[model samples]
Target: MTDSKLAIIILAAGQGTRMKSATPKLLHTLAGIPIVSHVLATARELDAAYTVAVVRHERDALVEVIVDELPNGLVVDQDETPGTGRAVEQAVASLPADFDGDVLVINGDTPMLDVQTLAGLINEHRHGGASATLLSAFLNDPSGYGRIVRTPDEPEQESAADTAARASTPLFGRRVTDRNGRVDRIVEHRDATDSELAIAEINAGVYLFGVSELRDLLPQLTMHNAQGEKYLTDMVELLRRAGSEVTVLPVAESWLVAGINDRAQLSEAAAKMNALIIRGWQLAGVTVQDPATTWIDLKATFEPDVTILPGTQIKGATTVARGAIVGPDTTLVDCEIGERAVVKRSDATLSVIGADATVGPFSYLRPNTILGAHGKIGAFVETKNAQIGDGSKVPHLSYVGDAHIGVDSNIGAGSIFANYNGVTKSETEIGSNVRLGSHNVFVAPVRIGDGAYSGAGTVVRKDVPAGSLAMNVAPQRNLEGWVATHRAGSAADVAAQAALAPQNAVEASAEQPAERTGE
Candidate 1:
């Protein structure tokens, strides 16, 4: 790179009507982050001396998000002109008057442009000593793009044969390179003639301008064209007219400069970004099964040997440690998964799973929940604001909330920490080695001491002492013959009558036979 100090101006003012969204187009996400944010991150990688983001549509919301990411960076509001040229004008006005350096102007919606490409553009601009340099690409279908127009290096010849040959050749608007093969000018498709429209090289809308030259030319922009808007493309003609060298650097990867104008374009950018991220992780030793179905956020990190199964979305600063296996269907946000832990078919947020812990085949771990080492929170369990100590287990069909379980404790299936009353929420604390039976409910503000046993159906409202047993059920009792007495003329009554008639007939037969023999 040259010794010139760098400044970046990001144009984010357009309302993007084609997006058909209430949200600003720049705020639309690509790979779990706003498109503008991705651009900002790339700009940061350039180490620019100053950065400015111009916002007009949804200005307040856009500014808030931008400030959160770039607190010290400048933000300028584009005025009523509503054009790329006007947006850059506002950004330039906000900069220090004495600052004269290279300014990189980029569309905020073009998140696919990487740092290497941007740095390459800047280096090329600086070394070429050109007044301006714009990135260009050759597209098979350049229907909506501005075409690059250049003059051929061939000398004019007066010979009749040479003239006929030149005239017969289709040289109207084709890529005519100079002796050194450099770009001359760009013609918008609307203004290009039939032959000019056939040109394949199109402008990529990314440019680096000398700050002094750009500042001088911005005011001279006129809205005399079809759109009635001041176009930045006009600056190329203005610079060249002033006898300044304007050049174009062709980018091989056209997607690098592709803009997100609608839902379809946004999806395309996302898919491309997803592929890049997945490929990076695979090279780093993380196993991502079915990269097409797995969506990992830019801020997420995965340790080596971690396996992410299909249908998983790991978002928002989540980190998976080595040997951890997560998901065939799982979503984790801002959580930490320990080494060797397994989280399958679960959704977790703001939680922590300790080493060797096992969670879910279907579980929901909410904010502040922490499962300790070797602990297990099995299928159909949901926990929030709870902490399970090392070796503790809350397996299957349970809800543990606002509670703390000691080491080696077993929370039986169907048990619950009923920490909420009609008005307030409280906590339940169980000591080490406590045995809580199935269907037990530890009602708020209670504690069970070490070695305490809670029988099935226990609803503990009061605390239990050490080594104690707690049960909350009535003693056993029998209600024999109650069905026959109460259910008369019903199935029970008829069955009882039929059972007694057999015994009565047997006794009657024995007595009658003996009397007849004596007579």
Candidate 2:
């Protein structure tokens, strides 16, 4: 809300060693986009004057990828693997020499952060006229977080009575002002006394600082913590000691304070992000039934009043025009569905469905396929690289490929365009008002002219001219006496073999008798 120019510093310099991944952790996709992309998009939404992302990973390819995705920003490399404070310092060097506005620091991994919340933090920082403002939250168990220790608004008069009153007051209490909200001091857990550790307020790692103040105290940050890394948190103590104005404002939501250090935490953050997108769409007149089961791509755009049923996967630059109904089991990639089109239980890629077209119950539309207005693609149908004319119907059990069908044509069941050979693919052209019967195969490089009709069971290998009836069948001939001749020949052969067996035995006996009498 302030006219003061704002610059965003995204701390992406860490390698995310705890992710245990070979690829850079920020490069991993969340909802079909890299995690850092979401953060960058949010920053752009806030209309920040400039956004610089700090990188310190081993792979330069990661930085190149980020540069390609975010063309407007400069990618500053932190040559040394120091700490977050040093990462910011590297980014500060890249800032313009005339920079004189407020600086906002956000972690790149916190993609689920909301824009309005960040805007509020920036407004407060500018309004309070303080050196720095921290986004803080209270946790039930704030074990690992840095605690907030409030110096009494008016220092206790160093008397026994005042000390007793301080002990009786709340541990992490802050005085609230009407204009700028609550105020407190930040103390790290390791550096805090036992009394301070009892406080529940924790730092959420989001910071807003006066540009001049950051430039002044940045050199004082040191590697004094247990991790032996220069901490940005140390600057809070340094700023307060220097009598510079500092304050901690409680975050409106606790989830905004969470950080992802491992896979389990990452999953939690992703679930929260999923809910946010789904709820936002549902409120915008897009029906997302059973939000838990629906997966909408982060970049997929839907016009107002679009309905998305459960079990839908819309990804990869797909867009649905106004008043369209999709899914309940549909997958679409790089496809466009025109106004009021219906797509159910189908897989579509790189296709376009015209206004009021109806597809599926079970359909597969491959790349380059287009369905005209009021066209119908029914159950068990597949199409590839084909454009169906307006009001045409390919109803039930058909495969139409590499072809163009004229308007008002009716493609029958079990009809297929055999568009491919062992060597090459071909196309089939069907004219207007053509009627194809069941089980007809139109072998390709073929054409059916206007008002033509094909008989059932027809296998067409050639083109049919307009207004013709094409019937295909092989001629039949009857074998009249074939059964009788085969039966007589079988009887005679059986009788002859039976008589020859006895006569052969008698001849052998007579020959033996003559030989014995002569002897």
Candidate 3:
């Protein structure tokens, strides 16, 4: 068997006390994935001989997640969150017994670390004849970072007692009167003088160490600091006393070592990572309009020539294929967009849009909704649990829920497959070439046969036979000559009343004889 030389140790054992979260801090998601996942992905790109993650808090959940999702890697439990030095010691137990090659030590929260930069640091360490090499950077604000110290030259000793005195106050620690000025001893930020605090160079918390050298020096670390923690920085001083060479290589970018301990910092890191992804995609022919308004999860895929317009948030395992256009303002979750499909101003969840299909300027495709090839879901449409057939059109003002539209059918404006009847939902199936009119409602469990025509305002309750026109309204009739008969009866009654009126007047005059003579 060929001998493998390199092993990677990831420092993930910290509980992230500053994070103050119930979820393991390393398991916290950034851009739709756990933070440690990004770190593991970066390490995998290096093709290290072995990868070992040092885990402490929430070990079981982290193990399951890493083992199931992450590439094959080893996990070692630190059991106790003692310190970074102790964490590495625990992981070292899992390394091969006779391993003698270089080791890469990295922090799990530093996902921004690029494998190329890490590889370059390791290469420099191997060539510098140094026992260890640190990935260092000069930050304008280096408050919490350890400062890198280097040895200059040895001073002449007068005698053995003098050597003991000088050893008590090493020449490296003494202020050197150089041509420029007196050089102060390199000190950590907490213990540094005001002048030393002004120094910019800092440890990046990433290291490349020779395995044998680390094995020898790890046990020498003591818990002597104010925090009662075994600091890895103190090992640098120890190695110096042992006459071993240590080098610091400034990281090409300072953000490579940035770690997240709080929500705000996590957000900042996520934004930076997303910006990197967007820039890379832009350089690769993917157009992301208004990058600030667009948020693409890190794992989401966009093929070449795909355009993501402003206000588009493609997240949660979604992928848009080549030539597709998504959103002037749209949200997609766990979805797949086919080639050249247009999903505009829509919200889709667990949905798939087929090739060349067009989904609306105002539409919602809920879970289990699938649009067939070249299907159109026009403006103000909503679909749930529906399967739209190929070349079918569910145009304006429609809710196609719990239904299946056959190929090439035209679902009219204001048409609704009213599949819910208070208690349960059912399916409405329309065959090919069925022309549904406006204001049509297909009640639950009804199938419209092929070539069936429904007039406007048709409420289809039952299945219509093929080639039949189903109308739900009654027939109308016209009435004539009815008014003429009623008018003739009124005229005859008026003449008979006039004839009776004269006789009545004569009888009245005879009843009063005196009045008759005067007439």
How many steric clashes between backbone atoms does each model show? 0, 0, 0
Candidate with the greatest lDDT versus the true structure: 1
lDDT of 3 by residue, 1-519 (tens): 222778899988888878889999989988888998888888877887888988878889788767865557888888543778888877777888888898889999998888777877777667767787776665667787666544444332122133223221111112211111111123556766665565565667888788887788898888776677767667677777787767666554567788888888899998898888889889988999889988888878888999999999888989899999998999999999999999999999999999999999999999989899999999999999999889888988989999887888888799888999999999998888778888899998998888888988889999988777766796767554344446555765566557667987889887985634553
TM-score of each: 0.87, 0.78, 0.80
lDDT tens readout by residue for model 1, 1-519: 423388899988889899999988988887778999999988877778888999888999899888987877899988888578888988988889988898999998889988888877787778878899888766667788887776554332122232223221111211322322255566777777887787776888898999999899999998877777778888888887888887776665678889999999998988888889989999999999999899988889999999999999999899999999999999999999999999999999999999999999999999999999999999999999999999999999999999998999999889988988889999999999988899998888999999899899889999999899999879989986676788978987888778877986998887784445554
lDDT of each: 0.85, 0.79, 0.79
Tell me each candidate's RMSD, in Å, in order.
6.3, 10.8, 12.8
Instruction: Kindly report which residue stretches of model 2 are placed more than 4 angstroms away from their true locations once superposed.
Output: 1-4, 20-23, 58-65, 141-199, 303-305, 422-424, 469-472, 475-519
For model 2, which pairs clash?
Answer: none
Q: Which is the leading candidate under TM-score? A: 1
Q: Which parts of model 3 have CA positions greater than 4 angstroms off?
A: 1-3, 152-193, 418-425, 455-459, 474-519
RMSD of 1: 6.3
Better of 1 and 2 by lDDT: 1
